[model samples]
Target: MATLMLQGTGSDVGKSVLVAGLCRALSNRGLRVMPFKPQNMSNNAAVTSDGGEIGRAQALQAIAARVELHSDMNPVLLKPQADRQSQLIVHGKVRGILGSSNFREARRNLLPQVMESYYRLSKQCDIVMVEGAGSPAEINLREGDIANMGFARVANVPVVLVGDIDRGGVIAAIAGTKMVIDSADSAMIHGFIINKFRGDPALFEDGYQSIEQISGWRGYGIVPWLSDAVRLPSEDAVILEKPVSSAKKRQIIACPILPRIANFDDLDPLKLEPEVELVMVPPGTPIPAEAALIILPGSKATIADMSAIRDQGWDIDMLSHHRRGGAIWGICGGYQMLGRTISDPHGIEGPIRDIAGLGLLDIATELAPLKELKAVRGTAFDEVLEGYEMHVGITSGADCKRPFALLQRQRPEGAISADGLVIGTYCHGFLGSTALRRAMLQRLRINSDGRDYVASVDAALDNIASELERYVDIDGLLRIAAGAGQ
Candidate 1:
């Protein structure tokens, strides 16, 4: 099998974006390439065509490669549940909740499954470019690490080390990572790429040579920062904090940044509206006094993050906003937080066990046995909405009296308060659709020329792919993957 691995010096070093670009670039050369990540730790997940949950980044990569997306691309996924604890998902199904100490043991048992998925994809694609999860220098995690060097070493794939120059310490990061990796894993790296470089590329010529000498690796390329990346939907919640100018009407939408943020993509549709400004106020950021709406984003750690929201003075801020006639919307975990109480008897989120919510709505939530996962079509605020559900909470109480959306041939999915100002839903990505966005904007007396969000992103990807085709040695990359070039 012809395979290559893209490992990073550290997290958020542009590995995910680079993989997407390379996938598009290689596919443009008339070769079929598939993106794979042996294991991933992300709350931002996408539903597969066959009805499975995989990392959102891998889904983007699949689209870039022009291939059908599948859960096999990411065999293992960990959704954070509490401090150093997470829900383990294997091949799209939940295994169980495990602490950080137990994940390694679980990973050892899941190796065969990982191999099964890898070889299956290997046989179906011309080339498989695998992306590693985090830094290889995390020596403390080296023994039980299945996502980085561990998987790369077993898969026998050559590696390309990608470093972010924008983060500074490009040379030190690359050199330090090399110094810490196992000898065998270090040897797998054939070359390195300097990513997210700003200013002139020639300015880094000397630095590149110095790095090459220190690490004894060849310089593959220096990739400049792509400014149009904002048009793309980001899977990482940490990267979604860029602020935009508020609409002329000054109608504001606020999102409480929960500890285990997940599936925040529900706001994408609202973001495109000219009359809407989506503001994410993390813990400690004071809520604006004149804000009209507050949104509570999805979180993996519902109970714990609810505590975090309470600690950040948001609890007080939200109450003040509500008293001022401001509207509040919640999704998934946030939906649960709107209720009077949340009972986590199983310790699914943390050691503290059960907790109370903001009580904005008259609902009460209990962590449930079965996770709801389905594509739902529904109605909310007189607008037809379509989204996917992925939550494990059963809600009840007076606020549950009004349904948020009409779904699946007459079933309603979500809660709408009597005043119609408070809304909560378990569905994520409900706003990415243009129809939904336009309707939301109209509610605020805002006018907008709706844009096709998905298409705009696809066009951006096409542009990046075209640019990469002109710059990279496409044929040489193919040959290298085929095990012909050194």
Candidate 2:
């Protein structure tokens, strides 16, 4: 088995998409490929087939590789719930909370577990596509780092540095990485790939050569801006920092961008609706009164996000919108916040034990040790809704009588209000269903484009794979991977 790692010159340099494209390219060549990330820090998570969660990006890569999602793909996940504290997940289960104080030491100790995952993946695949989080340039974090060169050196995996040309510092980002990182660490990096080039590739020929000359790294390829990437599920909330869609449409759907929002991509499918505008309301912005539907999104820390909602006075906006006859929906943690109260007696989410909910539904939630993680299928909106349930908490009350969907085994999932104006469900990816998306849009009295969203994403993977095959040196990368353990 062989392995090659892709590390970025800086954060968001297109490592995740590049890895996914490369995974599909290699898999198309009849190579058994598996994607691996030693450590990832993102609130956006995907429930794996093994009843654990991994970074959403790895899940996309696995899909590109035509393999089942595995928690071992990302062994250590840090979900930031606060400025300094993070929720720690190991091998598909929540271990505990990690604060700034013990973050380094805790990660340092997990090197063994990370390697365990890497070796297990190696046993099952001909080549493993390893992804590095952030940049290896941050020498300050290199002490106990498993996200970048630290893992590269320990595993003896060759690294290919990726720099973002669209960011306007491609030369410095690539060459300077070599200047800043230790000599021993720099030895792991064998080549560089320039990503997100907007203009003619010929315009930057000299610059690309300069990077190779200065960094003493071989040039892999220069990738053009991928417009289809918008169709893929984003792996980080940094994409949300951009302003809301300015497109004018017939109906409006509003959602708040919570501080610790997880799986927010559940709404990405809705963005494809031409007649509907999906507005993501940021902090200090009121939920638009013109929106026909208001969606309370999922959060990593329910109570804290609820507190933040109230702090932002969105609670008042929701009530006023409700009186005006606007529909409301909640998913996962948002479902918990729609209830009467949420109690965390065990302090699972810090000192805030119990907090008042929006009281839109009669249900109440109690946080428990065991997390609910599974794929589910059922009929909702008169369409077959196939999605996953990944959350922590037990919710039940009179609203349960009006279950949103009749899941398998006659199990009731979610709750619907008596007036049919409010609905809440624990299932994520509900909107990914084309029919469900059409149903939701029909409620807004708009028409869906009737696109098979799931298949579209699948096609997108193949498309990206074709691009990588054309531009990137897949054979060269394979040769490097073949050199592993030599």
Candidate 3:
């Protein structure tokens, strides 16, 4: 099988989107394709059909390829729980926590597992599209790096460097990358693509030529800003900081941005609604008092983020919102926080043995060593919905008798308060289901546009594929992929 790697000059330079678009473009041309990432660092994740989890980006790319998600798609996944500590996932299973002190050495030792996954994936498809993380320019941290050039060199995968022209200095960024990285690593990059370009391509002809002359690499193409991308779920947290909306007349659904927020993409469907505005409140901000619904999102560190929310006084704000009869809902770790207490005797999530919850629900939770990662179909709001459960705790109490959903397995899940204004559940991605989502929103007196979320995402993929076909040299990329294997 053929292979090619896409490495960006920096993170969030459109590498993930480009790889996904390329996968779709190739798939449309009747080639069986697979997406791989040597390592991925993100709290946003997707549950694979194989009972594992991979980065949300890889999951999107897998969808683009019309293939099932697999743990082999991302061998090394890191979910950061603190400033210097991350929960390490190796081959789709949690190995343990990894500290910054032992990160380099431990990561270097993971090369075998990375390669094993890559080789297994390569055997299943005509071509494997590998995505690199961060930048090879971070040479100081390049010693034991398995994310970028280190993986490329070992796999012998030819690279296509992608530079974000919208950030300016496109010429310097592409050329500077070559100047900084070692000669051996530089040789792996076969060409460069300037991404997120604005205006006419002819207008930047001179700048494009300068990049080619300085870097001695062919210019593949310039990609314009994709407007449809907003329809798709975002894997990077950087998007949370950007100014997204200004509409005030729409109904508001506010969610706090915890330090270790996981599965925040659950709000993407709401963002797509013209009459709904999903506000992500940053740290130190009050949860909007005017919000019609206050959603407590899943977190990698439940107790820590719960403590953080208290520090931000969001707990008080939420309590006030509840007293005002505003709807409040929690998912996973957030669900744990709605309970009377969260006990962690095994320390699965950290050192604290137990912590008091918001006490909105009568339930109590205890973190367990076993993590549940399963896709389930359930009935919520009197409509059937598909969602996945990815968490590590067991909750029980009186409120649970008033379950928010009943799964296909005849299991009662989630809880609802006596007043029916508060709710908690462990299911993620249920908001993507139109009927159920609409029903849930109807409770708050909001109107949904009745759009099919999955179809919209598929259409977005097709649009990106069409754009890539128009701008990028897909034929040349295929040739590069083939040549590398030969």
Supply every candidate's count of residue pairs whose N, Cα or C atoms clash at under 3 angstroms.
1, 0, 0
**lDDT of candidate 1 vs native?**
0.80
Return the TM-score for each candidate structure: 0.92, 0.98, 0.99
lDDT of 2 by residue, 435-485 (tens): 888987787677999788788888888988888788788888889999886
Q: Show the lowest summed lDDT stretch of 10 residues, model 1.
A: 477-486
Residues 1-486 of candidate 3: C-alpha lDDT, one tens digit per residue: 899999999998999999999999999999999999999999999899889999999999999999999999999999998889999999998999999899999999999999999999998999999999998888987988899999988888999999998888878888889999999999899998989987898899999898899999988899998887887788999998887865654888999999999999988888767778888999878888999999999999999988998999999999999999999999999999999999999988778589999999999999999999989898998998888999999999999999999997779999999999999999999999999999999999998888888899999999999999999888888888897754
Q: Give the TM-score of candidate 2.
A: 0.98
Give the winner by lDDT.
Answer: 3
In candidate 2, which residue ranges exceed 4 Å CA deviation? 244-248
What tens digits encode model 1's per-residue C-alpha lDDT throughout 394-471? 898887768888887878778877877788888887776677777766765666678887787777777777755655
lDDT of 3: 0.92
Query: What TM-score, to 2 decimals, does candidate 3 have?
Result: 0.99
